[model samples]
Target: MNRPSILWKLYIAAFYVFLFAPLLVVAIFAFNASPFPSPPWKGFTLEWFIGNGSVFGKPGVLMDPIWLTTIGNSFKIALPVALLAVIIGTVNAWVLERAEFRGKTLLAMMMLWPLVIPGVVLGISILAFFSRTANGLEDVLNTDIDSLRPGLPLVILGQLSFILTIATLIIAARLRKFDRSLEEAALDLGASRTRVLRTVTLPFLQPALIGAGLVALLMSFENFNTTLMLVGSDPPLPITMYGQMREGATPAINAVSLMLMLGVGGIASIFALTSKAQQ
Candidate 1:
């Protein structure tokens, strides 16, 4: 391999710095002994990890119920959304890729609409539509629909609307490269469609399926705007952090950010190592 040109080397260095500099700063501050987040690092301390009932006037350290609940809520939403997106998206991809139908291009374009729509707009639209539907249902049934409130379920629905499209696109792209003859051969050999799919197609699609689900989960977890508009009372971690930041910036917030960064980074590292080992 040829050595990188000076310009390319400079660009790579700049890109890495840009990507990691803020994270490095945040991690540094998470351990800084100074009360203020900005610093002149007084010294290193772990009190930021565990402090009095609050961090710089924001609820508390990571131990706060709100923070814990927010994290739980995020996972609750993300997990279901990932599962549902994979199911729906996989079906959609299969149909589009296997079935020869009219208006296929149009259908493909329509599938991409969610990706193109702004998150805030999508959230508001979903909230308005669900609100009206829920009110109508309540009027008809004379019962309340508590599950529709700003919580895990609503957040999942909001995220799935867009994230599912992404999953579909990924799976569909993979489907385009698949050999259909294998399924036909399996069916000719007495295997049912379900059996063929379960034994053959699914295994082939596993990598794409996993990738898409991970993408959907990450998108759902990090989502804020749609979650903000659709979520009623309880806020997810990002929203909770936003509220804390607005109220007052604190080292605890920084600490929480650092923890989150490390958690995600660690998961990514483990995945990479495992994947390499498998290879």
Candidate 2:
């Protein structure tokens, strides 16, 4: 085996440091004994991890319902979005891979449009269209419709616009590399299309589906810009965290962040191990 050059080693070290430095800081502060969440560490304490008060008293208190509800809302939005994205994206991937159609490139570009467009712009557009549509419905029916205001549905819609694209790309990449001979053999053996898909094609796509689902869930959970504009009264975790940060963040925020990071990391690690074992 060839040893890595000094420059290559330095670059790798720098990249690792860059990625982990912020996380290390957050983890450290989550246990900081100081009343203040920042520098000048007073001592070591785990009170913040248990949802204790910070230097800011009421504002710094952890494990508040507001934070919990925000997390719940995030999960509520993420679960549905991930499921829908996977379904739609899987179908899209299958179609694009198996069928040769006109406007294929254009359609592919359209699917990916959300990634290029700024999140704020997408949020505004969806909000405007929904608002206008809701108003028109109200005007035509002559009925009040307050439920359409920014909420879970709006958040889901906003996130789906982009997450679906991610799912499509992931599944499509897998499809492109798939061996069609197996599917053809199944068909030659008189298996129905649905049966072939369920038994053969789907098994191959499982890993990609799992990965896409995770990505979609994470994207929806951490989304802030679109959620802020489209989420009416109820805010997701990221929005709540942003608000807290704006209002002089408490150590509780760090605690919550630490918990989230750990949770996500644990889930991802488990998935990785499971996938490796299956392989």
| Candidate maximizing lDDT | 2
Off by over 4 Å in 1: 1-15, 50-60, 266-279
**Inter-residue clash pairs, candidate 2:** 150-232
TM-score of each: 0.87, 0.87
Determine the C-alpha RMSD for candidate 1 after optimal superposition of all C-alphas: 3.2
How far in Å is the alpha carbon of 218 misplaced in model 2? 1.0
Candidate 2, position 35, lDDT: 60
The local distance difference test score of each candidate is: 0.81, 0.83
Over 1-279, each residue of candidate 1 has an lDDT whose tens digit, in order, gives: 498899999999999999999989988998877677888988887777776644444344655676778788778788899899999999999888988889988998898899889999999898888888889999999987977655667778898889989999888888887888998999999999899999989987877777777777778778988998988676777898899888876677788898888777765665466444433
Candidates' RMSD to native: 3.2, 3.1
Tens digits of per-residue lDDT, candidate 2, 95-154, equal 888889899989988988889999999999999998888899999999757656678888
Candidate 1: count the clashes: 1
TM-score of 2: 0.87
